[model samples]
Every structure is written in structure tokens, then in C-alpha cells.
Target: MSTQVKVKNRLSSTVQSLKPSGIRRFFDLAASMEGVISLGVGEPDFVTPWRMREASISSLERGHTAYTSNAGMLPLRVEIQKYLEERFSVSYHPETEILVTVGASEAIDIALRAILDPGDEVLVVEPCYVSYEPVIRLAGGVPVFLKTTMENQFKLTPQELETHITERTKAIIFCYPNNPTGGTMTAEEWKTLLPIIEKHDLMVISDEIYAELTYGRMHDSIAALPGMKDRTILISGFSKAFAMTGWRLGYVCASPDLLAGMLKIHQYTMLCAPTMAQMAALEALRHGRSDMERMIESYRQRRNYVVDGFRHIGLTCHEPDGAFYAFPSVASTGLSSAEFAEKLLMEEKVAVVPGDVFGESGKGHIRCSYATSMEQLKKALERMERLMGRLS
Candidate 1:
């Protein structure tokens, strides 16, 4: 046989060196084990409410399965506008400012792709969502991490924001009602950040997916801050609050010019979000308040239960004011967060994500999601206590 030329590598170098998400690695392992009770995933455990499901089914049955506009159905966009104005005190013109996405995941990706230039820096708070750094890298941007520790209740302070700003900095991504840590920024915190953002002329990508899950105080949006709406890309979805993860419905609200750029990318990359999911999401916006209320209440009960349990078992846990996670210090176990999670799963059959998966600053902590049933949480706590007893 004639010798053939060696094939050149076709994959981009940008994708080659990227590490797989640390959150998914642990979940994959847990899924294969029998009798494992997982507190690992950040998704809500509740099923999609019946009303929303019926809306989707009805859409499908009516043969409304054809693709909608690339920006999504106009009615859904209008619904999103109303939802934002009424609930978040933010206003967006549906025709120009809103674009529906497959999920907030896609909204994050498209927003970065639309604005990033090679070597530009995107500031990310440490112990953030697993996807942010990788997405930023994929978009040809550098990820600059700012660490927020437990001493501050995991909230990013204004001084930290000032420290990270620089000539190359293009934007900052804020995930309040944060995943992993469950930390939320107050209105005053947003007020403090506004000057720094305005002074630098940097863009803000606010991921408020957990907006409906806050306790004690209402969730506030950075986009609502003075002089912020013009420079902000606000991303949210129906998943976390409405238990609509599988539905894959989300939207972004930004300036008309920004949305135009994002829409161009979306048109080519995604075509459009699922027609039926958008329809269902419209129903959710209109009528899912009671469902959201019930879910939040249940999560609050679970959060209290888990926080108290962690304290009793000798871990220092921050009482999260929002989101469904309990980020407790595992320093007492004298192990790194990864080691602690591995040991807990192997010895106690309980699964959790190591805090370090979020960043280097998360090394001594572990994130336990309390989105599951109270019964499961109670059992997990017992198993964790037993593991602590053995280690001590």
C-alpha cells in the first residue's frame, strides 16, 4: 500500500487544553454507584409544574412545532418583558432588548461571544458556576478570578472589584444568589459596585437565575442600579425557580445594539430556542407564581435544616440568604475539599461537589445542595455525622 500523508490536527488549540467541568466529573461517578444519595447537582429537584407542562403539550398538539423567530416567539418575548418590569423593576423593549435562548447557559455563551476580543479579560468571582471560566476561554477571553471568602459570607466586596480592574479588563460577570456558596449581594453592595463599573466603562453580565429563590429580602438586579442598564447583559431562565431545567428556556435583556449582535450569533448558532418550551415559559411567567412560592418555601426549610445539621456536626456553615446550597467549611476534617468529598462518598455514600471546583479559593470548603427532599437531606445529614465521627 502507498504511504498516506499524516492528517493534520483540525481541533482548535483553544478547545484542546480545556479541562472538563469539575462539577460534571463527580456527578458522573455518583450516577454509576448504587444507593448513593447526592447533594451534588445545582439543579432544582422539583418536576415542572403541571400547568407549564400542559402548555407545552398543547403547543405540540396544535402543530406549533415549526421553528419560531430566531429571537424566539414574539409573545414569549413580550411575556419576558412584563415579567422583568413587574418582578425585577427592570424594563426592556421586547422588540429590541430581549432574545430567548436555549437556556441561561446559551445566553451566557452568546453574550461572551458577541463582545469578547482575543486577550480581553473577563473578571469572575471565585467559587462561581463551573461554566463561566470555560465559556470565557472558549470565547478567546482570559478569566481573571477574584476570591470571595466565607468571612465575608462569600459576598464580593467593592474593594475587591476595584483591585481587579485594569486596562485589559472588558467585563465582569456577577452570579448573585450564587451557586456553590449560596451567597447573595444586597442592594447596598450593588450601589457600591456601580461607581467602579461606571468609572472603568466595563460591561456587566449579571446572571440572576436564582432571583426567585431569595429569602429575607427580595432579589435585586445590577441592571436595576443607576447607570447600569445601558452597560449590562442580564441573563435569567425558568429552570431554577420553575423547575424547568429540561425545558431549556432562558432569555437575555440588553441594549438594542448588544441584542442585535447576540441575535446574529444566535441565528447562526442556535437558529431558535424550542418553540414549545418558549410557549410553556410564557405560561410560567403568567401563572407560575404559586408554584415558585411553594418551591422556595420548601427549599427554605431544607436550607435551615441542612445549615443546622452542618453546625451540629462541627462544620462551619454559612447561612445562605439565597439559592439552595450550603457551603460549609470542611477544614475540621483536615482534608482538601476534593479529598473530603471523595472520602464522604466512598465512606458514607453521600455525594457533593468540592468547593475547589469553583476556584483555588474554595480549597477548604465543600458545597452541599439542599434542593432535594427533606427526607433525603435528613438521611444525608445522619450519614455525614457518622462520617465525621469516624474521622475525628
Candidate 2:
């Protein structure tokens, strides 16, 4: 036997059994192919704006490279507090209720780990961001998926929520202006959910990362709802709104007790979010609101163009009120989402994420992100039309 065979298997069964994220497979393929117009990625194509970039560089020049407090830098936390209150009407105490994280990704992991015990159940809406389920399972919790259909514009209804609740349900992972499907819940829709949440006494890990990207109506946080401030962990970052994906700056707002628990986990796993990134995020919160507005307007234009193009080509598209994606049905082509995506990439040189990568309920649809240029969008649409014509 090789010397390596003597190594102990220290890895837990939970880590070994987790399925790899399906969204990554297509992205790997897209990266190697040339001349491909990819609508597969959810990231904005824009570079981080000039001022925020300058802040990062200036922080480096000032030699502010030391690790911050386990929670985050105080100044950045204060800025986040102000931004949340002014923009979303959500108030959080800078010192006690807020924790700056590496990204909303870290916030999700910390929130789940802090709250979930073995066998606890987490409620997640279908066609959500892919990270939610695996993170829950990694925390030794079971994920209960609640399917939201396109007929309802993919928003989870009160009836759906009530039907999925059980004694083991400990928390709900809510993502609006959702991933893979650009579904958004209205204030009225959230009102319907409030009672069920209260009756169940469930903690809500609300992921509002795309909150600023809504087209028509402003985004609202479930944490802002009456009586919810105590039970909800609101997660967001500067990625989508500020074109700051690489910055890895995200923050969470919760009750003082919850923040304390999460901070303990955060301190060990990640001592702090990067000091430079935190400075840049502070600059964004302080001076980048206008930049966010400009980006949102551009996304709105692309959203309309893509949704209309899909309809004109005889595919059914649920009108997306938020986010930079459109989920269009590919069932008429007699192909699974994976098959459609493969064929589109191989033959048409166009790339989109298969909807089923999000969950089982996302089958027969494909997610097209409009985060690329309009010129690229035109090329992708033409390629898709050709693929559809050939399939028919």
C-alpha cells in the first residue's frame, strides 16, 4: 500500500456526501470555449466604480492593513447601519446588531451554523441561490424545499408556507429578486408570510442580496416587518449593486443575541472581512448610491429586452420585476434543461445556466442573466433563435 493510504480520514461524513454545485459545471465549460456569449453567470459585467476602487488603494497606501475587530471595522459598520436605515427603513445598532462578513455567502454559513442543531429543518424556496441547501446540510440540518411556480411569478405564497411547516422547521431561507428565477415578493406578499412565520415562531435567514436590483418597486426587507427585527437575519453585500463581487464585503443584521452567537463563529472561521474591502464598502455606502441607480437602470433595460425577445421567439417567459435574469421555458424543445444548455453551448456558442441546477422544480426552464452587454445580448438571442429553429 502507498504511504498515503496510512493517512486518517478526518473528514466528516456530511462533508463527503454533499453534492457538488451543479451551476459550476456549465461555467467551467463556458470558460474554455471561445467566442461564446455567456448569459450563464449571475455577476455584473461592470468594473467596480472609480471612487470605491480608489478607497481600496488609499487604504493600502495608508498602511491600514491590520485585521479589524472580529465583527468588522467600526466605521464600516456605522456606514452599513446608516445605509440600511436610510434605504430599507431597517435600523440596526452598529456595535451590537451588525456583523460584517466576507460576503453574503459567509453570512449565510454563519447564520445557519449558529442557529441549527442536528436534525433541525430549514425551509428554502425552490429555484433559489444554490448555496442555501448545502450550507444547511453542512450545518447538520435538513433542507425542506418549497416549490414556487411560475404561475405565481415564482413568489412563495402564504398557503405554500403554511403547508411546508412542521415541528422540526427551525428557520426559513428567503431569497427575493431570486437567483435562477428573477422572482420578487411584494410588501403585500410578505405581509401574508408574517403571520405564518410568527405562528410557527421560525427564524428567517432572509437573503436580500439582490434587493437593490428591482425594476419597478423598491425592495423591502422581511426584517423591517413589525415584530420581525428580532427573528430575521438580513444578509446583503455590495456585490450586485456596486459591481463589487470581488470585494467580498457583506454584512448581516440581527438581534443582539443572534449577532453575539454568530460573531463567535465568525471570529474563529474568519477573523474579519478584508480591511481594504471594508473601507471600499464604506465608501460605497457613503457615496455610491447614484452609481447603484445607474446600474439598476441599465439592468432594467436589459431585463426588458431579454424577456421580450424570449416571448417574441415563442418561448414562455415569466415577466421578471427584479434581478438581472429571465427564466424562460425550454420544454417545447423536447429537451431537459441540461440538454438544452449543452446543445446551445456546443452548437450555437451561447451559454446559459440550466434551471434544474437550482432545484428539481426548476426543470424545463433555463436561466438567462442579462448582466452582460447589450451587444452580447443581441448575439445570444440570435444564437438562441437559431437553436430553437433547429430543434423545432
Candidate 3:
């Protein structure tokens, strides 16, 4: 008899069927090449602010390494609560409404796990952050993709949202100041969608990870809306604004019952966020505002430059109101998004993520992140221009 382990069939059919990340595929490909200019990864090119690092180092120097409570350090939670109240006008009690997780990724997973029973439907607005559908499925929920268009500025209106709802719909995941598209929703738009959310009685997992990176306007948290607080699971983290991607810390704010349930999952899955990273994040909230603003300004400059560059290259590009990406249509080139990206990568040594991976609605577009330096942006623009010239 063959003694080989039958590991193939033992894998969860759901996980086994899941597709690999399209973004990471390009990132890995670029990493393998020499002198490839990457606008592929969503991570900030900046390092963590010096003061934040100093704070973490101080904690380590003072022998502060220890496991925090399963819910996370009370001090950090308090600061997060205060930060949210001041920044977004959302109030979450540190003791009862907050759960600090490994990162926004984990917060999302736990939020879905806490609420979703088998076959419950989650309304995921697309071209969103890529993780939403996979995470939903992992939690035994069905992901119902609702496509948003460039003509709509990628906003999910009450009308569009209502059309996608069904009796099985239990929650909606919103990621404004969105990834891939850099789209944002205005207060008036949220006001319009409020009734639909209230009508359906859906729980909301609001990923505001890129909240502070808005280009011209302040970010509004949906949790601040009247009667929306209790049903909203608000997730935000320091990775984007503070350039602390390596820290792996993020927090979720929800009502007591929801938070308590998530905490139970968090305690068993991840005991606490890294103690050192928590201390660093506390310092960031306390004193890193100026550094964050400086980074935002740099990103704003880059956004303008990249947008103009795409237009100059004869691509129709929408102005992203927030986040670091510029989503430009490659349809004019008469090539698929994957074709455009691969050809550009090979010809010009420039890397960008194909938009289709975000969702079907994202096809014929490419996401180019402006989180890199001006010099690199200029080089990438020149290379892209050359490629466009050849294609045209």
C-alpha cells in the first residue's frame, strides 16, 4: 500500500479553492527583478517616525516586554478612543467597545467570524481591498460583490446598495478612502446610504485604515452617523499614516456585545498586539501628528504628479480624493489590464497592480501607488510614457 499522506484532499475545500493574491503576485515578480520601479504594493515607502521608534525602544529599555491583556493595553486603548473621538467624532469606550488586534486584517477576520453564521451574506463593495471576500468566505459567509463604477466616483449609493440586498444579507463591509481606487464617500453620500443600512438592519464592518491619508478633505467615520454606532465595527490602524506597516497593530471599535464577541476570538487567536508596537502607537497618538501631516503633504504632492503623468501619457485617470493610489484606465491601450501591466513591467521595468484582481468592475484599470519618492515616481512616469508611446 502507498504510504504517502493524502494531504491534498484534507485541505479545507474553501481555502483550497481560493485564488492567490493578485497584488502580491506582482510584488513578488518585481522583487525578483533588478531596477524595477514599483508602484504595486500599497505600503508606504516611509519609515516609522523617529519619535515613535524612540518610544518603542524606551519601552524595551525599561524592561516593558510582557503580555498585555487579551484586549490589549488599557493605556493604548484609551488613547485610541480619544484619538477617534477627536479625529472622527466617534466615541468608543476603551473598556467595552475596543479590541486591539494583530492588524486591520485580523480585526476584519474576527469581526466577520463574530457575526457570520454559515451562509449569511456579506455585501462587499468592489473594487475594494482584496481581502474582504476571502475573509468573508473563511468565516462561513457568502460574499455578495456589489460593483461600483468610475462614473460614480466609486461611491456605493443607497440605490446601488439596495439592489444588491437579500434576506440572507447580514452585513456590509465598507472601505472608504478605498484601496486600489482611492475613492471616498462624502457626508452627504453617507447620509443617503444611512436609510438603506437602517432599512436592512445590516451590521457594518468599516475599514478606515486609510482614513487619515485623505488628500483634500477630512475623513468622516460612518460610525459617527446617528444610530450607526452600535452596528458598526470600525477598523483603523497606524500602518498607513504612521508608516508602521511592520508593527502589525490595529484596533476595532464596536458595541459592547459585538466587541466582547470579537475579543473572545482575539484572545484565542492572538493574545495581544505586540507590546512594543503598542507603546510605539501610543507615542504616535500622543506626538506623531506633525510627522503624519508631513507624510500626508508628500503623498498629496505625489498624487497630483502621478495623476498628471497618467494623463500626459494619454491614459484617462480619475483624481483620487484620498489614499495613495491613482487608478487609471488602460482601456485606451486596447489591452487587458493584465496584458498592460505585464507588458509595461517587461518593457519599462515599471510595476503596477492590475485592477481586475480587485473585482470585475476594476478591469481595464491599473492601480499605481504614489507612496514612493518623487525621484522614483518621475522615473516610473518616464518609463510608462515610453511604453504608451510604443503602444499608441
Window of ten residues with lowest summed lDDT in model 1: 186-195
lDDT of 2: 0.92
Name the lDDT value of residue 232 in candidate 1: 98
Instruction: Return the lDDT, model 2, position 197.
Output: 95
lDDT of 1: 0.93
- For residues 1-392, could you state the per-residue lDDT of candidate 3 as single tens digits? 87976565777999997989988888888889999999988899999999999999999999999999999899999999999999999999999998888989999999999999999999999998989889999999999988888888888877779999999999999799989899999887899988999998999999999999997789988889999999899999999999999999999999999999999999888989999999999999999999999999999999999999999989998899999999999999999999999999988999999999999989999999999999999999999999999998
Given candidate 2, what's the lDDT at residue 46?
A: 96
Could you tell me the lDDT of residue 232 within candidate 3? 91
* Segments of candidate 3 deviating more than 4 angstroms: 1-8
lDDT of candidate 2 over 1-392, digit per residue (tens) = 65655667888888888888788888888889899899988899999999999999999999999999999989989988988898889999999999999999999999999999999999999988998888999999999999998888999988888998999999999789898788998777899989999999999999999999998888878888889999999999999999999989899999999999999999999999999999999899889899989999999999989999998887899989888899999998899999999999999989898999899879999999999999999989999999889888
Question: Candidate 3: minimum summed lDDT over ten consecutive residues — where?
Answer: 2-11
TM-score of 1: 0.98
Candidate 2 residue 304 Cα shift, in angstroms, is: 0.6
What's the C-alpha lDDT at position 221 in model 3? 85
lDDT of each: 0.93, 0.92, 0.93
**Against the true structure, what is each candidate's TM-score?**
0.98, 0.98, 0.98
What's model 2's lDDT at 320?
Answer: 91
